[model samples]
Target: MAGHGDSFVDCGCSVVGQAGGEAAATAQRRVLARTASVCPVCLGPAPAERVAVGDAVLLVKRCPEHGEFSAPVWRGEPAFTGWVRPKIPTARRGPGTERALGCPNDCGLCPDHGQHTCTLLIEVTQRCNLRCPVCFASAGQGGGRAKGLEGLGGELGGRPGDERHEGDTRASRREDDPTLGELVARLAVLRPRAGDANIQLSGGEPTLRDDLPQLITAVRGLGYPFVQLNTNGLRLAREKGYAARLAAAGLDSVFLQFDGPDDAATARLRGLPLHADKVRAVEACAAAGLGVVLVCTVARGVNDHCLGDIVRFGLARVPVVRGAHFQPVSFFGRYEGFGAPSGASESAPGVATAGTDDRADDRKLDDLREAARITLPEVMRAVRDQTGGLIPLAHLHPPGCEHAQCSFSGTFMAHEDGRLEPAGGACCGTGGSGGAARDAGTGGMAPEPIPAALGAERARSFVRRQWRAPDPATVSADTDGARGGTLATPPRDDFERFLARAGRRFSVSGMAFQDAWTLDTERLRGCCIHVAAPDGRMVPFCAWNLTSVDGRPLHRNGAPSRTGVAGCGGLGSGEGAGA
Candidate 1:
């Protein structure tokens, strides 16, 4: 970030471009030749199409049927905030595209996850009670070298026989190890100070874990403060007081997988009919006074017809069902060989893409901006209508962006109406696209213009920040002894100091979390910074060695990050059924 001075490149269409990807000259050619003119949702010409505005090509798309969205570009700017914010490139993994390859697939952000990220995506378990086709967790499988609690625990650099964390060049983790303390200690290290640390409790149905309550208690015991659970609803719907029991276990909310109503949606998405049960689960949670965040994976072909309906469902349950996150199908685990039909006369840019439904490969970052037909302000206006109320888009200014132009990052909003106003929705890699602002003191900042170069990369870094794939080099021998990655540890005194700055004090109510939201992530990421433990295991809440982008210091999880963490469930509470 220091020696490099090549900030903005000339989209060359006019002024120089920012430090993102290609400039206007290249972007225009890509969209005109490879992109389409219709809205990916309704298959109609995007509303307010903003094409070629100086070095940028803005696209403002709104649909009465689908959600509202906007993409703007100004390739002619200098580097993103002159090193104040820089993109952290994701390491290419064993098998995956070079990223930046999905945007062309649709009008959404880069399928490479153009935006949004949760530094820590705590999936309590890869096991689920119900087996659904589109289940993102890809859970509900049997044993036999399964990566269960230990797999999860090792994420924090502590999993049992956890010797690899020692940092010994020769030290490494074994194949199987399950220790809870190492995980707890690690979480204590990663727990964000100001913002709630996100912990998504997933499962072969966490309720199935007889030790579910104890696990929840363990996470609560740790100072997580915020917790969320992802479930199929079998336990909560059928079992009476199931939700109550979980609430009593110190659960904050549930990111229930409610695709649609009736068995139709359930069958289509889950490959089984359980709509009734799904509704029951939602109701049960509401009855138990637990916040509910509906999780829907918007498949282009599978449940294409239900997009609008899902929004309405969330709107109807507003306030109680805080919000809903829509993830366009990701081609992973179970979705590996999946394919979506592109035969529709007027389909999205890359409708026919296989196993890439989630990545916007149909539309590249350049294409999305070129196809920009909607604006944040405009999208908000439409959202207000869909929600049957005024969901002023202004309410959703990309809260924690890494760029000056709010749009350069992704889009996100702090909306009360159950749907994300986040930079981009989870669907089509939405959350981290727009780089809007929020008050610095109160988590609000004024909207700024976007620079081209920083747009895609900034968004990528955001997603990487949220990606769950830990470094294999860091795990092993912590809680669940298993071969894994290497991680750093946090200082104890600094951890305490960070917590104090976050205004987080335990309430006698026995609740560890209360009103956590994405305010200033820079000030909250302290929780994620950590030091390598004596044994080389990654520590969770250790709190030392954590510093801000500028060494200013930040709390963990910021407000917006908190929502994803809490909604996914079981984050703050790391223990799953096995725990």
Candidate 2:
């Protein structure tokens, strides 16, 4: 009744839809104009054709000024518990550096993961209130103790990672247990980059610490850029203003663990119906003005059906909700009964590199692919359809990812309302590069600037406020100068690349859905760094993982054990390394 313009706008305005002008059809698509769809960035009624025909995923939008831009498909409003709301009026960048991961072969920057090891996260405790089975930290395996596993260190068996403290068990283990003030003092010695360096306080449950807020205050006093907590929402929801208290104490944001709407799935993952609790926690975080990046450990056949539901949940939270991040169950650390029979996992479709590899008991990146059983792009497509095209791959997609598409986990799609787009969607990590955007990162979108569409005010506002780094570049190199240390490059491939290759080796994919997908050659050469000093900084141009990154088997994804390898032989932070 209104006009074709109304129809285009109703479709949520493709990036090229707003500007109704001549040549507005975009040579990119107007060049193939048999029929025009809708575009927002370039204005209405633009020659915007769908990329993946039957996919129903509005992949790209053609804009005359912007050429073509990524677009997400939106579904509808989300369905989360009524109480939740956003805390921060606007989303702030979460923890971690803009350019954290590095480029393999020394592409450009100053190697050592671009930003260098400015901030290194240390998990003091692997204990938690809930036994989330999906937790790679293996909180479920513990007996609800305050620290890590009881006597048995590492996984359920084998030698503990950091056993230096193990001997301290006799006569009041105080020296081995570094207090917050003590930890901060040790951190001070690290001499993190002046203003750029940061410190993330992660654990089985950092909030579980009786003196968390106080310790956070101390960490803040250390002049850290921001302090973040990785937690499962128990104390956050129950303790009113808990998040705000930490925020005021210099806590930046929270990496909250959240799945989707499936109460059953939540129960399975958390060993309890945490759906309502998680919602309450989000609301509490919002009320506290704390930014949140919903973290989900995506597992095929587990809660995959709830992908759309997850995005919807995040979006409804509005401003406080920055975005959702997905971490396809990395088969590292302590996750026990979570993967497939083969014990491998993959990222979502189009996102996964290859399939998981056999012969790997724990943390074989290759084996993770087999476990994930999906590609990165395919997951991106699902996210787009679920979110109703509001969140595009480029907007929330990964940057320089192996594939053009990023796994839904590391990305957060933005929408006009200022709240996150596809709020309730799920997330996880993995790779894919069958040729999509081709420039997004492992946890970010392509380096390209976001289009000035949506609203001139809103668009400009976002570019100025939300964008974290101008160019999120990755720095990597061999730095072998022919140095020594079990550091052997992967034969034809170096360690980082080889590991990345292993990361994607096994997995499932395609509508045909085989057990494998494509792998990003660059990611395979896993970035390697040698901890040269006790400051927690990684030596530049170091070789990738030659023998083992952390420990092998039981202690592979080692957390700092007071008496583990981290603390053994005075090897800088040795005890802290083997959690």
State TM-scores per candidate.
Answer: 0.43, 0.49
Worst 10 contiguous positions by lDDT, candidate 1 = 506-515
The ten-residue window of minimal lDDT in model 2 covers 79-88
Candidate 2 matches the true fold with a TM-score of 0.49
Q: What is candidate 2's CA lDDT for residue 513?
A: 10
Best by lDDT: 2
Residue 265 of model 2, lDDT score: 70
lDDT of each: 0.35, 0.38
CA deviation > 4 Å runs, candidate 1 = 1-27, 30-119, 142-185, 192-196, 340-396, 401-579
- Tens digit of per-residue lDDT, candidate 1, span 282-384: 6776566566666665443455455446555644543235455544343222222132212112333232334344234433422322222222233332334
Top TM-score model? 2
Clashes per candidate (backbone, < 3 Å): 156, 137
